[model samples]
Target: MQVTIDKNSGYCFGVEFAIQMAEDELAHGGMLYCLGDIVHNRMEVERLNQKGLRVIDREQLELLHDCKVLIRAHGEPPETYALALRNNLELIDASCPVVLKLQNRVKHAFDLSQRQDGQIVIYGQPGHAEVAGLAGQTGNRALIVMTEADLDQVDFARPVTLFSQTTKSTAGFYKMKALMEARIAAAGGTLDSFDANDSICRQVSNREPQLAIFAAQHDVVLFVSGRKSSNGKALFSVVNAVNPRSYFIENEGELQDEWFAGAATVGICGATSTPLWLMRQVAEGVESMGELV
Candidate 1:
């Protein structure tokens, strides 16, 4: 059997930058606190944690004082910064530039909307760290639309400016935008009153077709990803749809020997938040499962 790792797999630019920052900070002799998992992958988090990266939440952040904290790539709401200021906690901001730009755009749009009765609409999972950060730009007034059920909460009659989380599916965002436009048009609303930005990151959007191709070329796919990764879920669906033999796993330990049955070729890949080293580990695990025929 042959085992290969997808060249396009592993951490994105934002995640790479964040992990680097954490490593650089950890290299220094001092206590370091990260607001959340440095990356969504559990193995990466554990690796960092082994080097003294303390994970803390908002509530815990408030109780701490005069500490140095690193914000993960997911970005944080404005309240996090404010609390850090009040608590005298120095921040190591590692928010992705794409996300930072989207946040600014959302905030600007929200500010402009406040002049009228307009509302800011975001296409993202509710309560997701990135989505929460984007919603915070609208002072928590941005309507989060994750499904058809949430779409009803948006006011089609009023002016709306739509934005999406950096990692959301491009097709999904397009559908959301089209649905909003249809709703407004059906209600006799003018198109000029509504605006939506294509905020989904191209790096992720481009990976969909590439991942589908990778999945199809293999007999079985081991897609490594953290359970908490939104991009992981989105990309995995693409692969699974293309190749039902695809399997998702967090680590090499999750690999079952039975999965390799009758498979002459196996592919190993992962989400943007996944580390390359973890993919290598998974490949090694597959190698140990049996002899290549």
Candidate 2:
């Protein structure tokens, strides 16, 4: 059996930066707490946990005082920073540059729209840390639309400035934008649609086309990613769409020998949040199964 691995299948720039920062902090030999999972992958988080990187939530933050807490790649709102300040907790902000830029843009757009009596509209999953951070910038004035159906919540007469989560599907974002435009048109109100920022990271957008091509080269494909990762879902969709023999797995333990049956050529790929080491393990496991056969 032959096996191939995707060149682009590994930690993205954002995840890479966050992990490196955490590792650097761990080297200093201090208790480092992360506001959330450094990334979506459980293995990576566990690995970091073993290295003195602690993952905590809002509730944990309230109890701890005078400790170092790192913000994950998904940036937090200003309120989180305020909390850190109040608690005297040293902060290591590892917000992805792309997400940081989006946060700034959200703030700017909200400020601009506020002057004109308009509301900022975000096309992303509500309650997501990124969306909540963006919405919090506007003092909770931002409205989240996860689907076209969510458009009904928007006031069609008000001008809407739209932004997207860094990992959302481009097609979905555009579809929601079109729906918002149509709704305003029907309402006969002055709808000024400001520039729609395609904040979907390049790491994800570029991977789909590459995965499609890579999948074509193999007889079977294995896609590994965390179920909660948005990029994982998006990239897996592309792999399965292009290669009917593709199998999705969350980790090496999920690999099944049946997938390798009668297959001579196999390929392994994963989302940006996936660790390269995990993919390597999956590939090795698949090869071990082939050897036994």
Give the Å shift of residue 286 in candidate 1.
0.8
Model 1 stretches astray by more than 4 angstroms: 291-293
TM-score for candidate 1, residues paired by index: 0.97
- Note each model's CA RMSD in angstroms: 1.3, 1.7
Tens digits of per-residue lDDT, candidate 2, 97-133, equal: 9988889999999999988887788888888778888
What overall lDDT, based on C-alpha atoms, would model 1 receive against the true structure?
0.90
The collision pairs in model 2 are none
lDDT of each: 0.90, 0.85
**Per-residue alpha-carbon lDDT of candidate 1 for residues 1-293, written as tens digits (9 for 90 to 100):** 79999999999999999989988998986999998778888899999999989998777888999989999888988999999889999998999999998898999999999998999999998889999999998889999997867879988889989888889888788988888888899878998999989899998999999999999999999999999999999999999999999999999999887788899999999999999999999999999888533
TM-scores for all predictions? 0.97, 0.95
Candidate 2 stretches greater than 4 Å from native = 291-293
Name every residue pair that clashes in candidate 1.
1-293
Give the lDDT of residue 18 in candidate 2: 87
The candidate that wins on TM-score is 1
